[model samples]
Target: MTSFGRISIMACLLALLVACGGSGGGDRATGVEPGPTPPGGPVAPPEPDLPQASPTPYAEAEALFPFITAVDIPDDGRPLVDFQLSDAANTAITDLSSADVRFIIARLAPVPEGNLTGNWQSYINRIEQPGVGPGTESRLQATTESNGVFTNNGDGTYRYQFATSITDLPQDILAQANSEGLDLAYQPELTHRVAIQFSNGREPANPDYDWVPASGATENIFRRDIAATPNCNRCHDQLALHGGGRVEINYCVTCHNPGSTDANSGNSVDMKVMIHKIHRGADLPSVQAGGEYVIYGFRDSKHDYSDVNYPQDIRRCVNCHAGTATGADRDDLVLTAQGDNWAQYPSIAACGSCHDDLDFSRHAGGQEDNSRCASCHAEDGRAGSIQDSHRIAFEEAREAFKAEVISVENSSPGEQATVSFRVSNPLTGEDYDLANDPVWQQSNSSLNVRVAWDTRDYHNTGNNADNASSIAANALTSALPRGDGSYSVTMPLPIPDASVGPGIPASGSGVAVIEGHPAVAIDDGGSPASIPVGDAHAFFSIDEPDGLPVPRRQAVEINKCLACHGSLVLHGNNRADNIDNCVSCHNPRNTDRETRSIARTPPTDGKQEETLDFKHIVHGIHAASIREQPLQLVGFRGFTTYVYDEQTVHYPGRLDNCLACHTDDGFSLPLAAGVLATTIDTGDDHRDPRDDTVVTAMSSACSGCHDDAVARAHMSSNGGNFATTQQAVDNGDVVEQCAVCHGEGRSQDVSVVHRVRELP
Candidate 1:
């Protein structure tokens, strides 16, 4: 997710601007049924009263496009990156964390009027920073850090000291170098000649910019190539391309034109089909049924994807597009069309419902010339040419473990120290079967180590604990649960230890934090399954030996602890006297809502007797009227008065708790044994324990606001619309559509939440 420039000048300007168009209007297919509206869609009409500076509508200059240009990775192994920004060059990039930049155009001339050169096409290719990846030893210059600071060493091979102008570059590169024939007409002109070359050859060749003969020690920062806003090819042609390939439209600029790239795969088919069609439209369902398939976003805004899921009945091309796709696989590119066999038609019906043990109807030897899918993903068995089969396959398990951070073991109450490390899980012998994976379906290869300590700076120190009970007894170490497999747990120090009963600190030390979760590779939202890895923490620290004494450790990064624990009412510190271990799972099982109890079965639409448990006087009278209201009632997805931050995406809104479940304990005693009450209050002075109360005997008669004949037979439990027997208990009725289906746990009657107390 980082990028700035140079991948053969962004793959020959993304295949010569993929054939430019979208001067802002005209390509409307907004989906979800609005199909017929885009020719001028999102509401189009005001072109007549123009004149006064008539040059805005490239769809209103693409709606003022402030920012959202992501393309990040770009070292030789191209994927595309050129993102632009203009403010007449004041260049105030706002944020994608520090504006991010990089360069290397070399020579691209066209300035006809004032002072422009022509017929040049050079580019040399060698700036390297958007997200580092090529070999490693040549060190002309390098530096990295984010949030903690020190960003942009000129884009890795050096060249981003910031500041630039030349009209801000983007008008689809004069229509992508006039479809590669270099046409630069219109009120047009160009120079883009950058070359900062550094590894200390004292700023190598700068005939105003052209350095690419490296040896180390980098610097080059001169930038140019501006002029966009002609509705920048209407939303960068609906982003998410190069990968899923195809759909920045216009047959994707004929073949990604402008002195194009893809020389048998240096990559440029308009940036590898827009990054493989935006990671395969992040796994569609028409973009996850409106939730937009996701990985995240920023090329112009709105795309978070709330954790992409999509998997209700398989689809997603053998992970990287047939011919078996495996050369290790992690994705950089893998499909190979042109003559179309995609391993025999619809890729074997999208992998026959989960590899149905692969028979593809006898390998379709009946048609669709699959060529036997290269016998198993072409490593060397042949079927190559998707540019020799899309490269990247977990690079030796991604360079087998080298992660660092080797020490930080603070602890003192007079003194005590012991923190350890050693972890590995390379797997080469292949005796596999960790339950065929869903992250071990539910733990078996279970290797977890999460120790967090700082015991709030060793509480009252002096070796801590002295009968002073409760803060968890001085707190230091207690969440230990090791499984058998790859085992290890030294546990033996604590200059202080001993809390859950007297002064809480559990151990005699100040800092004993150690972490490790490892298990990577996972992909089961459903079907053509994938599970290369999972879990991974790895953080390290362990000093306290050279003559004893090192009490202060620090590592942070649970995404900065979700910015204040994802807030909402002391954020779940909701009592057993404040966070009683979050009532295990937010209360509900015993009896609260003033000892609630009710029922009356019979009515399976027998026209009477219905009334189920009414959840503790209806969630304790709407949670005591929203804790006596004054504005604190947010719940339902508003997550109680919201608050998020995520660096500044902000939220601060929402509320709603209602003891989570009319809880004095929870789930109100199996709904008082499936209710059948008329008036039952067996007294203890109404359960007096400082007045515990339960009231009943008809709370004020009239059967407490009627409904005596069982809430109209449980609201006609479906029999009212009858179609009957499709099964999970009726499967008949209709007319309920609470927003078409309930939220989250989505259930429109698959046993209506398990037939709520079925005595009917």
Candidate 2:
């Protein structure tokens, strides 16, 4: 017998046993007892004695209680369903009346055979074949009056008779099916789906629980395991729809199947097409070609997703439909059944749903064949594979220009220190001669080779105030090319004055930062894309009398940022892709005065300056949406203002999910005490007001996100203002008292303030 026939036969047998008051077998396994019948009135059975258990141990219990065990659609026209409502211990739940149960019956139409022509009518015609017509409410006999009525069998089971004709379909739909030679009475190919929602006297907060029999079916043929909900929820926060009521993908697919279409837009509402078009949004070729994708829902309300831009690269299919990659949760795209078209075949309809500009006639010759797609687009395919097509050239070739700092000679400050370094392509293991190769020569002439010297004891002390200077060079002064694939540059180092000491003890241990960026062009069958191939010094310390080489404390993990940004490139893409390198330039003492236009005037009331402090700038940029004032920054080009109202800069994930981009207790309070104060230009416009303000380190980071008037006032009250904090610090004031309340273990700590509460 066929799979459906076997399922139907088994369902009938189970229904028969329940009707005759026989236990549906397997009582010992469930620890359930068959109840005795009562006298006279239909002989009601006694409730089974159940063991006391936790409120929700359903996962461990493997309980099949309160289940719609069997649904029977007889050939002779009678349609009914048998239900067993009980607790985890198999005690029958007779307290639930018929009103407590709600049922929805739907028909599962098979996938269309041919390619879906863009014409809506032609698509509908293909799905309207014999026993394959649209499963509308009228066709499925789904009406308030036609709802099944429950008849308690008095033996821990209930029978609900549909009391409707098997062929009870709308005239128009029935005529279409009949014309296509439909045998409605014996349509074994057409499957039915039954959904049930029940309440067991739970509070309104818990409300009712819903289940679909076909969704939970053990038989491989019946279960629908397409894109799981959790996968989508990774980015969407929560994949809820239909007025935020329906959340399950199983329930959504039932009505959004091949048979479904929007009556208002006359568009296919199939799950594959709808979801693809929605996520692709404004990027869809059709939408870019001056067309809008509008889904008309209940009351013909239109949902135009033309402005919805997906956060990540949409070409990264594995981001959503996970594969056999490390860290991936599930592989939903892998086909589990033969006839599941979306999983089994690469069709024009599915692909064109996103790439709407695809010329179907030109590509397929007006044919529906997609069998050859796998040959080129398969996962393992090389050149023409989907992965290869979307592979970013720069990301693949990033290691080509890797550089390392070899040594820093001449320990004393006043002497000419010799800094040695080497550059090599890690991918090819070829030593890159900066003075020889044309590309390297061009990069050297542009002074891409940079070296910075700073005291290792004081992290982020790279301002003009601290005797620190960075030098850009075209070639090494000595030009000593060693046999070990290394080169040297001798340059005069500024003498460190012992009297010019800050809060930290003046120590001789200094750090040397060597970085270089070489331009490389990668042709990946499309445009010849030019990108900066770069690397930085891991660590190189200058020997000092009393100072010890201390590296900067870890704050943010660059890998975590790359998880979303793919590659974190900033400052006109000249900077190396490392947080340590970024911190070296974007130190707390540095400001964007040189980059800012000297001719431009400041706003009358506020300053027109930009703080390049990594902590302040990074936090402010990410929290720009909540700021009351604009985040103005001066760069290589000119002044730029990030006004949240003017431009949208959405941080893809939850703001309070700090671990998404942080590591090593990065967000922990009681920050490094002696960190330099952050400068803030509280200018209303691009112009500086010359009233630059300096805030305490902690205050600057916190105010980036909490930049309201009240927060600013609070900071000001605590000697943490822009203009006064620096003066207070100079006068030996305790400006770092921010930790009094916002420190770790305090009542109002950073964790407490940024804590994410569950949705109400």
Best candidate according to TM-score: 2
Best by lDDT: 2
**For residues 487-567, could you state the per-residue lDDT of candidate 2 as single tens digits?**
877754332333223322223344455554455556735433334455465443444444345566677777656554445
Which ten-residue region of model 2 has the weakest summed lDDT? 1-10
| Tens-digit lDDT string for candidate 1 (150-220) | 12212111112112121233354444444445433311123233321111111111112222222211234
Query: All candidates: CA RMSD in angstroms?
Result: 27.7, 12.7
Residue 274's lDDT in candidate 2: 72
Clashes of 1: 107
| Model 2 steric clash pairs | 602-687, 602-688, 606-689, 607-689, 608-688, 608-689, 693-722, 694-722
lDDT against true structure, model 2: 0.48
Against the reference, the lDDT scores of all candidates come to: 0.24, 0.48
